[model samples]
Target: MTIEPRQLPAAQRTLPAMLQRQAAEFGQRPLLRVAGRSWSHADAAAAAAIRAGALAQCGVTRGDRVALMSGNRIEFVEAFLGAGWLGAVAVPVNTASMGPQLEYFLANSEARLLVIEADLLQRLHTADLARTALQTIWVIGEATGSWQPPEGIRLVPWPAGAEAIAPAAVQPGDPLAILYTSGTTGPAKGVVCPHAQYFWWGVNSAEVLGVGADDVLCTTLPLFHINALNTFSQAALTGAEVVFESRFSASGFWPSMRASGATVVYLLGAMVPILLAQPEGPGEREHRVRTGLGPGVPAAAGQAFFARTGVRLLEGYGSTETNFAIATAPDSPRGGVMGWLRPGFQARVADADDAELPAGEAGELLLRADEPYAFASGYFNMPEKTVEAWRNLWFHTGDRVLREADGAFRFVDRIKDAIRRRGENISSFEVEQVLLSHPAVAACAVYPVGSELAEDEVMAALVARDGSVIEPAELMRFCESRLPYFAVPRYVDLLDDLPRTENGKVQKYKLRERGVSAATWDRGPGAPRAKG
Candidate 1:
């Protein structure tokens, strides 16, 4: 059953309003369960109301942006909803960011206050704490925290339970959260997501998963990402329970699932290989999960996972800028294909001129909502970038995909993630897909390093499976046998582990900057070229 985007009830269109309604309808139902404690709908709603009042006490006013950086927990959820209850925008910072990047996010967001986890206090460098716009700092875990504030900035403890007050009136178009995603070529930019956008995400996910009131959604990804935040939204919509872990642990994942009694889980594509690589356990198949929702799971891995456990892994293609535009049903074949486009949205595969490309041809993905205010509002404080992306009256996804005539789409790679070798554009995604399909490879990131000539060279960082050491030469021979000579990775680096963000996305820019390292193996005619 295709769930088309339809009008949500007026009360459910905004976060604060929706929480109030759900609290009234299901007061005793646990909406959030963490560390053996539960916060029912009424409890959460009341807590958010009090937190909003606390933010107001900190001089936060309507439309003010409150920067929140924390791990996956109930406080993160409360702060986000509380800020929205006050008609303010919550800027969720990536906990992995440090120093200048952290400063850049604070300055760029113009956040009036910062709410951070006590454990993450060290990541905010001295220079970042000295920023002028940051009026106050709210520490979540401790009453008297370790970090001291500079003059003119007040450091306060996180607010506890207070009397519930009237929430600020806000419309669906108001900003809910400003989410930051690193650019392929530049610093991170904040994507301004509106209240209505999240509402639709919840509605659509409820329909796609057939979430029932008794079902519980479990997420290991941090709340900073859309996949996790929107999972929260869908749980609220379906009146379902949620179990959000502080982090993803491949070793303890099955145990956590069994303990939480989770009926659904969310993950990224990279997690698929990592989870599959974990040594098979006697208890692996003994869990309650019915389905998983995410992107990037290989078709073979998806099938293998089902054979191991009765859960079906559903694939979807989306970004911070829009609701999930393309997704698969539980039984859809995977192999990097993102499945069919849902109703209430129009999509196209197009060239630079915006002309629609033929089926099976790869090009930029353009998306627009069939309903108003269903996508992101724009990029915060970056009008030129926003205008450029939203130019031609379509939101340019900056991703290349092949769209079949039946409206099914197969993701190729990000436009900036492509490697040009001797004038032929090679998809880094395709290269990784090949490497991952190999039995010895556990996880890998394929990227481009600059060539001495006009184009780029293919480089790969692979994590070999335990007990099966892969020699660079053997992997090169395998790649050469499967891929075009030019398309094969000329430089290979087998690493103990790849650098990853908190959400598990490989930071390719770090690998590119490292360039050809001492450990890099060269299969080409000369020494590994380091030319930019």
Candidate 2:
């Protein structure tokens, strides 16, 4: 049976309403499986309703934004759906955030309540939360821990077994989540994702992957990423089950899949290479995994994975601002190409003036979904920036891509001044600002240096003050305390001056060309190089 997502026509109303319908239709079928535990559709819906009731007791109101910070635990899903059931916006915070970054998220999101894991409570101190509209803190684990709350912020443990409440009526266009993506400038901007957006994403992905009731998706992606959230949405749409893990470990990847009986999986940047590095053992290819999704798999790596595991790796391209626009089929034409545009979506390769380029011409990729709210509405609290990117009526994907005469699209490079490392989109501007904050750093420019592992690594090229002697290790320590581990630079280059245009704009392109020169201070973990 194909378990059509629309089995309960009433589900079209809202996200919470959809889960209720799924519970009624699917009954005891497993919905979320993590480690040794499992929650059926009915169990999850009932739990969410009761959780929503508890939140209401905590003074949660409709349209309120609740910030969630946790790993890939079942509690994260419970809190997310619970917030939605109350018609409140759920804000998923990146767990990897440090003090300054976390502070910015809490203040910028204007979330009154924050739900976080007890272990992560240590990162919550600082006056930023005190100055914000935030008032309450809900801890997910042991409450008797030594962690302290901010001034004026009331701390409480997650309430137990509140009675189920009626789900608030939700519309398709209602603001579902305010997902924060790194901005080209300033702090991370929240992207307004509506209920309809996720619905289409779930359904379309289900269709592309040929998912059905019998399938089990093994997802190690963190809940902070849209990719992980979609696992639940897609499974709910079909009658499939998802086995969740806190994070991906190449050593434990196959073992977990085998134990969970997972038929499907997802990957991110550099995961293919890591998995390939592991020595093959007996029953490696015996797992039931039939298909996997995500981009950034090299042609040779893809072939290697397929030849060894007998499972097809399908590559697709998209971002938080845009859903999956381009994807390769199970039997795509070539090895390195991200296949043609998916149905109902229009994409064009355009030059600076939005003039459409011919096939095989590499340029910026602009996409517009035929359906409304299928993509994000705009950046939250940044109308001017929204208008800037959505100029001429199309969302400008800062990616450089090429389209073949046969409609196959190949990803070329990114035109934006952003960096993608370890599946995390980082703002080069934000990173440079952080480095510039160091008093010893007179001038700084951050850029991407290609990583043999996969995506680009953060590399900083800076000019120290005339009398300052900045140490690479010390600089990294400062960044480690302020930025997320992934956003911190892996390579540092101290220079007397940086290449700049006649107009005083730092020519980062030239720095990108002079990546990791002999004079460049290489700090990455490997064989030592001279700092000449």
RMSD of 1: 11.3
Best-fitting candidate, measured by lDDT? 2
Error of 1 at 112 (Å): 1.3
Clashes of each: 1, 0
Clashing residue pairs found in predicted model 2: none
lDDT of 2: 0.83
Badly placed stretches (over 4 Å) of model 2 are 1-3, 6-13, 143-145, 525-532
Worst 10 residues of 1 by lDDT: 523-532
lDDT of 1 at 438: 87
Q: How accurate locally, in lDDT, is each candidate? A: 0.79, 0.83
Q: After the best TM-score superposition of candidate 1, give how far the Cα of residue 529 lies from its true spot, in angstroms.
A: 30
Error of 2 at 100 (Å): 0.9
